[model samples]
Target: MTFAVNPNASLFLLPDPVTCFRSASYNQIQTFHLTADASAVILDWVTSGRRSLGEEWVFSRYYSVNEVFVDGKRIAKDAMLLDDSQIDAKPLPERALAERLRPYSCYATLFLVGPQVQAVIAELVRRYQAISVMKMKSPDKVIWSLSPITGNDYTSVIVRVAGEETEDVKGWLGEGLEPLRQCIGKDVYRQAFR
Candidate 1:
């Protein structure tokens, strides 16, 4: 069965400036990224426009608990503006870093986040659609393993099972294990360490 979005949630691009789940406004989102490089002072937001199981769905079960910026505020605890003054001068202001997003599955919604690294992912998927890739699974977490060209460290592809799709927890075993293998096909990039 295909993954489905709940009726209440609505997906929006970055700069939407709306609160998540404040109204009939809750939904599934795949690959949601709100990255702020303070050095750049510019925010980079990426949403795959897919709630679940499109490009971001490598595995069948997705469950996650991580900080997600909502409403352009850097949230530390319970939407408190506790550290607003201290983080204002930083390029991407810590304000945009702390806003937390929690998906209430009792509401049947599993809000996914990622694509903080997208170009890397799109290229790998394009190159290895038919080949089997290597994967390392830890519980519901599957990480895409990529070896750096210069040496032996690996860049990871994160795979998760959102809470709403509880039925497919068992199907994620085989998952997209091949992308990891095909992506490392002797063409791995040696990223200049920052």
Candidate 2:
């Protein structure tokens, strides 16, 4: 839940709210539904928070950008992570996610929540066929329900973190995520989607 989607990785700009909210259209943010291939995460923008803007993967490993003048240096890679403080900063929406070198495509998942997650998921699978299937199940002990964001296209479901839980699994595999796994494992998420 606590993933550094933010370039700066700070709560100041992208605050980690305790609850997930949504827009009337059921899309509040652009989520990347990524599937982990052995050592890397391959993804296409799931739902562009800005529905009208469209999605484009900033593929650097797959493309070259020598034109974005970088003081005359050939831009091998272009990320706004110029400083550690900016780790969670949101790259201006103009800059889509850039591809990097990775030996394997790691596993991942994605989905939306708040009030519209369910409606969005249903529509994606039913109408677009983008999501073949999905089911809601309880994942947490105290939480009311865990409506996992499932789809054939996703390897990792990016759930919005609620405060310290982000720190719980901030490392990508820890208590927070472990508990989530208990709620929806590979087989479970797959079966439900299938």
Candidate 3:
């Protein structure tokens, strides 16, 4: 899917999670074009198939691409490809895609750009910088990272998260993006989380 945000306009994109069924392959590409003064919030996420049926990452492959452009110049492009059939385990135990992404059943990526989201970006940066990573005996329930996109005047940020449960990630994202309620309106923001 493609989107174009006009100058001085704001856009919010929060789509449903993509679920790949057994032996299925899924591919998605999303592009966003925005003027220098435009602002946008985008969310992309995927699940480990139908967990209740024990179909965790049983799909053959999954691919996704997200690109953002500002003022006709590309600022950020993120791509991910996961294929279980491409690996060749010779003489050793075969490793599945699930093994590579073990301890996490859900993954999400969010993009915040333009002047409207500067406050949210600043808050995320503050919270992310305050975190102290320490050695843990077991993996944590959820993990996330925040990075700023260069060449955007510090107005763009990308956030990636992985969680053991989908709901956990959703809750975390909802809380983290609470500041956007003022920009996108409480009703519109609530719909995204719900």
Candidate 4:
């Protein structure tokens, strides 16, 4: 059975060379599978575009989607999206596949702003060590003095802990944060432990 969505969308199939060389019929079947699998397309990212004084600037929305399928299945068993907003700062498909595989793993992202942001981050690292969570990736923090000429004061980070809830993580790190100077945006999630 053939499946199609947007009639305007074109499909290209790269078939197995060996089978294609042996018989044209086998090549046709492989081509069919490729087109069939690609019939379903999802919009993963869209950014707002506006012109200012005849100049256009494109901002990064950081929106994306990852689809996982079962063994030998084309249909996705699970789909997850990177979602963050002022009201709801959480990753999509809360019941993700990794959650099932590793029950104790947790992930949290922090967006901080302050002059003492570096000190706050240092204290946070010390506390994370106390909790014994592995630092999966190098953090991306910006210091005022080291930052570019543009006066943008904000630091964003992603960290993984050993629990599903990041309440403790936020509470401890939130201590040194200054109300007027610091602003924290966080998103908590569960994933397979590495």
Best by TM-score: 3
Model 2 Cα lDDT, one tens digit per residue, 32-65: 2111211111111111122134322221222111
By lDDT, the better pick of 3 and 4 is 3
Worst 10 residues of 3 by lDDT: 85-94
- Weakest lDDT window of 10 consecutive positions for candidate 4: 14-23
Displacement of residue 6 (Cα, Å) in model 4 is 44
- Candidate 2 overall Cα lDDT vs. reference? 0.24
Which residue pairs of candidate 4 clash?
A: none
lDDT of each: 0.25, 0.24, 0.90, 0.26
Per-candidate TM equals 0.18, 0.17, 0.93, 0.24
**Which rank order by TM-score, best down to worst?**
3, 4, 1, 2
* Candidate 4 residue lDDT tens string, 1-194: 24332332322211111111111111111111222222221111111112223211122122222232212234322222222222332664444223332332222322222232345445554554465334756432211111111133223222222222233323322342323122222221111110
What alpha-carbon RMSD in Å does predicted model 1 have with respect to the real structure?
20.3
Question: What's model 3's overall lDDT?
Answer: 0.90
For residues 49-123, could you state the per-residue lDDT of candidate 1 as single tens digits? 134434322112222222333234322111112111234554654532123212211111111222233344444
Candidate 4 steric clashes: 0
In angstroms, give how far residue 50 of model 1 lies from its true place: 39
Ranking by lDDT: 3, 4, 1, 2
Lowest lDDT 10-mer window, candidate 2? 37-46
